[model samples]
Target: MKEFMTNNDYHDIGFNGPNYTWCNNKEGLARIWERLDRIWLNSKSIMDLSNAVVKHLPRISSDHCPILLQIENKKMHNNREIRFKNMWCSYEVAKGIIAKS
Candidate 1:
């Protein structure tokens, strides 16, 4: 999983609320808690969605707490607007091609 994430440029977006996401309904020492759920973002998403937030909602019925991703800023930038066509891809080579053109 670490290798895959590294290869794919995936990063975990830390959450707010309860630290432990999973819990075994038990008393005292028998109880078990762990964080098994998470929200991951790719390099592009991390860069484009800078205002995104991950929230860990309260657990009601299930053992795992629900996660929510809220995008505070939908627009990429307020000062300037950049547009891309459907045929254009945002790759390294594509950047060079667009720059050259």
Candidate 2:
């Protein structure tokens, strides 16, 4: 899997979700089921790759449920308040306010 990911230029968020999905069903010999579904993404396609995460959802009739991805990135409007205030005021008031402040 690592080799395949590397070949495809994909970055792995690492193994997440259920470990095993299939189990042998037999009498006297009991078997437990596990998770098998996983998620992956391209390294170049993601920003702040370290902030990306995966979570497993509840399993239904299928052996594996869907995986959820949470990605974080730098806020585009980090200084939106300042920009909004500037836009709200005219040049004369802005100059006066700046001078007073």
Clashing pairs in 2: 18-35, 20-34
Question: How badly does each model clash, as a count of residue pairs?
Answer: 0, 2
Q: In model 1, where is the ten-residue run with the lowest total lDDT?
A: 73-82
Give per-residue lDDT, candidate 1, residue 97: 75
lDDT of 1 by residue, 1-101 (tens): 99999998899988899998999988999999999999999989988898889999999999999989998866455676668775676566687778775
TM-score of each: 0.69, 0.45
User: 25-84, model 2: which lDDT tens digit per residue?
Assistant: 445647666555556677666654767777665566654566778777755675545434
Mark the regions of model 2 whose C-alpha exceeds 4 Å error after superposition: 15-35, 73-101
Q: What is the lDDT of residue 55 in candidate 2?
A: 67
